[model samples]
Target: MPSLRHELLAYAVPRVRRSRELDDAERERGRLERWHSGLDRSLPTRLVRHLHQRYEVEVDRTGDFPTHVLTPRTHDVEATVVWMHGGGFVAPIDAFHVRYADRLAQQLRARVVLPDYPLAPEHTWADSHDALVEITARWTASGPTLLGGDSAGGGIAVAVAQSLRDRGHEQATGMLLLAPWVDLTTSTPSTAWFNARDPWLHLGKLKAYAEWWAGSPEDLARPEVSPALADLAGLPPALMFCGTRDLLLPGCRLLAGRAAEAGWPLRYVEEPGLIHVYPLLPAIPEAARAWRTTEGFLGRSFG
Candidate 1:
């Protein structure tokens, strides 16, 4: 029998897809693109807010955009996790992911910094990638830097790590991805099966949004734009976490296979039954365990 969570998501996923007001696929995607822009401040925040009670929220707006730092009491701070929050490059930051950076910071006993990068339609993904690179370079300087995020951020983290390796920077220690929506191709077989099972991201919505993101195929194929299509060669070790019910399951499996082919160490945690971005729901029992598992992996892989 399917877990309650999976059943619930299965029921809820189609509702979100059918709820789209736009009559045509193209227009509906454009509407979602605009709708995602204003979510930065309002998307739920408890996962991080709860953890914040035990730690301090530090902001470094000293740069172009708002950059927040979460630090817990710990002696070792040599390693850092440069966290990029996920919202399909459509929002500044989602509340679902804000807490994750905090928890990881507290558990790893290392500094964690999150960049408030822009999302889709309003700005190009190239703009977002540049901002990511700028902040990641600074964050990794003090010590080993681990790249991580849920969903889109996870994909971004992988892209940056692959980029650094390609340049021979030797900075990326590893990457932790949670239900990462990597393959923008939208042709994977899972699209038909998990599409209805996965909530939050609709294939129809993403396809429309992705096309709007890039007017050209070449632009979309850029590693930073779509890590699923990016060459996994010479990339840092990666730990990909995806729920069995997530629509992204197949893409992650493909990423893992690429890592193997490229000779990159790959660690995957496919929770038997969960939904998209479950790691951000650390308040839940299953979410907490998922985070602890990642914490142990990060501790061993990072400095």
Candidate 2:
């Protein structure tokens, strides 16, 4: 059973952010406008203030997008974490993502780099994949590095890891995936059932977002777009979390099964009746427990 707060949030978040009744093109245009206007990528003022006061916040603008590096004021960094923020490949990084990354940096004594990746409708996965792979590779070269993300970002993390392996680049020491949207095809047999039960995700909306991110119908099955369909061998050890109520659970299970078959060391945790990305939720018992599990995993992996 989930905590009361979890249950309440599960019901409320969907209502607050659910897709409006509009055609796919209209939604795409609206999102592109938001991206072009720069409103979509803006960090919350409160979060920015908090980061400056508590941590060393540095921004690197050399890449296609700005990467924000957050380092704890008092802790010596044990590792580097290149964390991707999730927005279904369409929305921009939310405050919750920065907060979650900050929490991880503090708990793990790591430097967290949050990349502001290009969003969809205006940009496809190809626009950012190689750049992200290079960024991740550079970080992994320095020290023990972990790649992590939630939702669509998790899918990107897995794809980047696979690219690193194929290219013989320095691989991340570990991966942390939270409710990853690994299969853009969204063809998992249980996905439709879970979509109906999921309060925050709609299969129809996700399919549209997938098409936008993939850039074509055929590309939807590409490993870069649908990592669950990719070969899972020779990747770094990974910790994955999913909630039974999430539409992405079937894909998570698919990836976990494939990981096992490929001898990939993956720790998968499934929480019943909780919402998507439960580990990233703030002030919830479930999130706290999930963070503890993550901390333990990082400790062992970094050792």
Candidate 3:
């Protein structure tokens, strides 16, 4: 059974389906590109104000990305979390991303760094992968760090970790993924089936973005683009969250199984009736519960 809040929250998102009657692909792409540019321009001001209420925010430009370091209002910051913002590889970072990073930092007594990575249509995975690899590598080198992100960012986090592992470098102490879209190809049965129930994700829109992020079919099969096809052995312990109503749930299930087979410590929590990236939305009660679970996992992992 779904929580009352979760059930009610579904109604807030418009039930806009992909149809030829609405618009064409070019129009959709233009709209998304414009929206991403606007959001990128607007997020810094809004996020700085919101994050300052809880922590000191430091903004630094690293290569092609802008990194926001959030040091919480605490004396002992035990760890560092390099959190990636999810935008389906096309959308812009939102207030929810900032809030989640701030709250998670506070909960774990850790400093959080959120990076503004390049998005699709304008930029592809190739354009942003090396920068993320460098960022995660630098942070993980200092000590044990938690690598985290939601949706496309989650996928990026995993890809970065895998690259580091392949290079014989330990990248992440632990990984926290929120409704990660591990398989960009969406080759799973549930990916298509769950589209009807998932209010936030549309298969058609997702396919378009996936193509933009991954330039070719061969690119989709690359481990850096889709972690589902990557070897997972010897990586850090992971905690993953996904909702049954999310289009990516099936891929997560496959990932859990693959991790188990590879002897990786991956704790996958599938919420029965929740939506995508529920924890990012603080208004929902499930978000609190998810945060509590994440905090507990971090505590035990650190201990």
Who wins the TM-score comparison? 2
Residue 69 in candidate 1 has what lDDT? Answer: 73
Error of 1 at 137 (Å): 1.7
Candidate 2 lDDT at 188 equals 83
Instruction: For each candidate in the order shown, give its overall lDDT on alpha carbons.
Output: 0.69, 0.87, 0.80
Query: Which rank order by TM-score, best down to worst?
Result: 2, 3, 1
**Residue-wise lDDT of candidate 2 within 183-257, one digit each (tens)?**
999888888899888878888778888998999989999989998899999999999999999989999999999
Query: lDDT by residue for model 1 over 1-303, one digit each (tens)?
Result: 444654565567548546442258656557756676545543345554455555456777766567777666435566677887876666567555666665566566667788877556656666656667767877766677778887877877887776776665656677788878677676677677877765555676666556555545557766776787777777667777888767678888888777788777888888866777676652466666776788688778864
The stretch of ten residues in a row with the least summed lDDT in candidate 2 is 40-49
Candidate 2 residue 157 C-alpha distance from true site, Å: 0.4
Clashes of each: 3, 0, 0
Task: State the lDDT of candidate 3 residue by residue for 80-136, as single tens digits.
Answer: 889988978876667778777767676667888887887788888998888888888
How does candidate 2 score on lDDT? 0.87
Best by lDDT: 2
Give each model a TM-score: 0.83, 0.94, 0.91
Could you tell me which 10 consecutive residues in candidate 3 have the lowest summed lDDT?
Answer: 14-23
Q: Rank the candidates by lDDT, best first.
A: 2, 3, 1
